[model samples]
Target: MNTTSTNCYLLAIESSCDDTAAAILLNDKVLSNVVATQEIHEQYGGVVPELASRAHQQNIVPVVTAALRQANIDKNELNAIAFTSGPGLLGSLLVGTSFAKSLALGLNIPLIDVNHMQAHILAHFIDEEGYDKPTFPFLAMTISGGHTQIVRVDDYFRMSVIGETIDDAVGEAFDKSAKLLGLPYPGGPLIDQWAAKGNPKAFPFTKPRVDGLNFSFSGLKTQIMYFVQKQVQQNPDFVSQHLADVCASIQYTIVGILMDKLKKAVKQTGINQIAIGGGVSANKGIREALTQAEKNLGWKTFLPKFEYTTDNAGMIGIVGYLKYSQELKDKNNYIDTGIHAQSRLKL
Candidate 1:
């Protein structure tokens, strides 16, 4: 039974997937953010969810300690604990959610529930001190490894998915294509690097069949597979020799597909302010596309600098700060240890 109105420091933990991350955010100021990524799973050609969970169990504590140290705060000075509650690996989310709840109960402080994807959008605000922040009624495109969606964000906590994938997500498409090309498990970054050197027009890929603002990447991924299979049949060294070109071709096609829907979302939502978030947003091609859209469509665009585009606990902490400022948090928000992860969540 803790009820206090005093200003406080927020501790945020994130174990939604392969990374175990933690941070300390005071108000809207990010004091420290530390992340521990599980590198062992890379050899498996993709994340093994169970392995990711085991890694979180092994890494959560040290990561949190590092975050607290970076923030220069002792555990006793903390105000409340915040963590991602859903839309991630159930086992992974449980690690952070349960830890946060237990810590809050022990410290007699409040707890905040954070939506991982929403935090990715709000990541734009972390560490920004007294700077201009996006107002209500803006558009956010959350493109990550597992999910791809364009959302209408009317406020920090109030959002709705305007459009999304009918099949594979953009990031998943990237990794899957990379795997076929004999690239590593988390092939998104590999695709980006390879695309940088290759000609984007080298290989042609068809856009999705879905209309309007929604997205579909399954067809494009299939096209790449068949295209590559034919190439390999002719020259077994095709991917090895033309890796850059295939990456360029595939990356270009994917970015083009996203831009098509992004433009429409703006037109239909009638919101000129657009923002891009998530790991895929870190791609240089997407950055260039958004910049072009800004100039061509006369729309205001924001892409968080490359560092903030990926999964990080600082974003969760920032969202926690926003909710705290709005008086919308409670210790009771803590997990019951029976929580689950949702592969998808609205806005």
Candidate 2:
């Protein structure tokens, strides 16, 4: 699509997982971001693909409507429709993809495809009055339920995955650890909350010695499991007695692992600018850890607002706006409207 106009209006949809989110972007400004969370998965302990997709179907329309209403924009004014196209549950991605395609076609607008993982990184650019955007050649560490990666972003579309988890992501490690402690679904946040009240060094857990920036959290999970089991054997109420300590120790280990890798990336890439995105970034421990890095390591950090930190359409709209700007710069930079949802799409 080619547009010589400025301040283009974009409607973005995100149903990559359990949340059905919609947002409106006027140029780089995010006017509205509405996410309908799926609490139905709470009882199940994790997201159930089938249930997530079903909930998305039920929430998409109203979510989009609310987003537009909040943004005070009409569908007819949209220059394009952007939607997350991959690296998510196929069923969930399809819900957003189908809806975006239909709406784009109905309004005769172009369809913009966004990678779920990339959106997590580009989320740093979502408009905030005084927020400073990260310059190119920066390192972006995206830690989420499905991904943990260190990316070298040279430009809008020029990104390279420098390192990533070979097995489980940091978010999974947190949630799984919480499960071992009898916490509820999406226990990552709960762990963070409790971690605040306990000593992070209360318990000792061996950190994985993975070479380079590649992460391995499966072993950490196993360590916690066995440790918890042994404690329970000694005392049936061990978890209940030390819930806060357990959470703090676990969060401490995870944050250390992440910060160590981030420091290594900075040293290896010589990129002083570091940014983090995804749901895991919302953890208070991780946020403080990263903030401390700026003072100790002379590094500049970018952290998105809590709302944009999680899976949301506002991030998708940022990508759409970037791609649209590319088209404006060079008409030959045409985006493929023929794109489809890719469940395992790479960043």
**Candidate No. with top lDDT:** 2
Model 2 — which ten-residue stretch has the worst lDDT? 328-337
Give the whole-model CA lDDT for all candidates, comma-separated: 0.84, 0.91
| lDDT, model 2, position 210 | 97
For model 2 the TM-score comes to 0.96
The top-ranked prediction according to TM-score is 2
Tens-digit per-residue lDDT, 1-347, candidate 1: 32365565889888888889998987777788888989999888878889999899999999999999999989988877889886888888878877887887788777788889989889877767443466778999989998899989887778888898888899999999999999988999999999999999997888877977789888888888899999999999988999999999999999999888887888787898888899899989998998898898898887886656787888888888787767655444543444444544455
Query: Candidate 2, overall lDDT?
Result: 0.91
Model 1 alpha-carbon miss at residue 344, Å: 5.2
Question: Which ten contiguous residues of candidate 1 have the minimum total lDDT?
Answer: 331-340
For candidate 2, write residues 211-322 as lDDT tens digits: 9999999999999999999999999999999999999999999999999999999999999999999999999999999899999889999988999899999999999888
